[model samples]
Target: MSQPTVPPLPQIFNFLQLAAQNPTQYGGNAADAPELTRILQEIRDLSIPNGAQHSAQGLEPYQSIARANNPTWNARPDLRPKISKFRIVKHTHWGKAYWSPVDLLGLFFSRLEPAPLGATVRTFFLPMTALFGRWAFQLVGHYAGMQSCMWKIQDNGPAQFFLGASIVGYDADIPTCGNWRRVIQKARYSLLPNESLFLRDWSFANSPHGPIHPKDDYPLGNCAELYPYLHLLRGVDESNKNVYGIALKKKGVRSPSYNDTLQGSVWQNVQWPCVKCRELIHIQEGVLANFAPYAGSKGAPP
Candidate 1:
């Protein structure tokens, strides 16, 4: 005997169509269910892809616009997205300076892919991606701001030195940026080529963590390479604006959704995030809980 075949998305799309048309028949009310309404609105705003083009690299992100590979989705070939790298500066508490390459998507609850999703997949899940897209843009902006997440791949010792001197998950609750913003405002120091604003708070400069490299009154234009961190995030792009328009424009959007974390078989794999990535995820959850518009986190007490 053959195994049962699952219905195709087109068939499921039909069920969704009928369900949206007459929710009461299914004993549900669209007005009462925000999730259903978000889905239906997304279905209404979907883009119809014209055709597929062959590319040197073929890739599909798990969600929508994430360009970073999901370490968690190794078992699913359908979601082998490319990993995007972003660099950040770091000053070890020991006074050594270093540049760290971070997996852009691994830092957040998102993934990155090449351009233009398949027509069917895009139509089905683009709206759903609002959950990720909204958080991603906001998180990126936060990362570009004063405080952000950093990871240590090795250990911190005089032996490790710049190789990495701290425990992988020792939270650097210490400040990453201090006052380049104010320094620039007052022209206290000649800024480097793209060093417009600082990404850290004021205390970062004096933090026990070694921030002694950047000078207060000098032309860093010559010593540009000295600062480790850079101001990365700017703002949301137009693509994100159109994507999140329908799916996450409400108060509930600020709160975490069931879709925020990896779901289903993806978690069964052992290639999960390392301690550093897990630490970043915990930071994101805490941020959403404390700052999300609804004023609470899913992890909060009822």
Candidate 2:
């Protein structure tokens, strides 16, 4: 039998360089698209394991790490045998973006409430929390939905930042799941500095653990669960009124393919696919409406 060959260090380094230089083009429109895609595919293939068929082959290390991180792992000693047998492939093949077992467990808990899996059938079932977390963080990139774009400060300023959005669950009642709300608060604070941060969408729903209703006024905070991951864009400014308008028009005018809608684009683009763009448009429209009629009037509020 022959040993499997791994990608060369040089190739990996080159990929990283390309990714850094032109983050959007590297994945979305690189000249070496086929080759780059193939490399990524190969890396993913080598990293993630298949289903339970191969679960027991070499998963002890991962299971041990998970148990070490999860305080409640030992709470159900009866399920230990099955939990020990559970195989979780949580890391990504891209760069050093691998997730520790602890990270995976944290994500699991964020989206789901833990439950006792009786010993009789625990072996055949993976926790829903674990499965959903993996799907949202890992598999989401395979589809097309909203694109992540970075905005630089205009006129050669030193600030450049990203607005992060994920399909993570949100419940005002659950302190652990309130990360999305914190992100919004941070974005609002950024606005005072003439900088902006916006995420794709967030979830607003009644809490599963308590009687907490999602805030209807903070509409920008609700994001659907199945939105596709988007390619990141460079050299856009979210704060500039002109720049923001252009980006909004570009997204709004582009016709989504039928396939896109079928694949959950409707959920993704519900109110506005990009929350920042919507805010910008609202501001621009308000200004225009207030000023357009004053063009011919004398001594307007210039």
**Local accuracy of candidate 2 as per-residue lDDT tens digits, 7-117:** 343443354445534434422334444434433343333322332211235333211111112333346555543333222233432221212222222222221211222
- Full-model lDDT for every candidate: 0.23, 0.26
The worst-scoring run of ten residues by lDDT in candidate 1 lies at 158-167
1-302 per-residue lDDT for model 1 (tens digits):
01112234345346555665655554445453443443433322221121111011232211111122233344443432321221122312122222111112111111111112231111322223233222323322211101122111122211100000111111111122122223232221222222222432213233222243444321221111112111111132221111110112222223333222223111111021222222222322312121122221123222
Query: Which sections of candidate 2 miss by over 4 Å?
Result: 1-14, 17-68, 76-141, 150-153, 157-165, 168-302
How does each model score on TM-score?
0.19, 0.27
lDDT (Cα) of model 1: 0.23
RMSD of candidate 1 to the truth, in angstroms, is: 21.3
TM-score of 2: 0.27
Model 1 alpha-carbon miss at residue 258, Å: 23
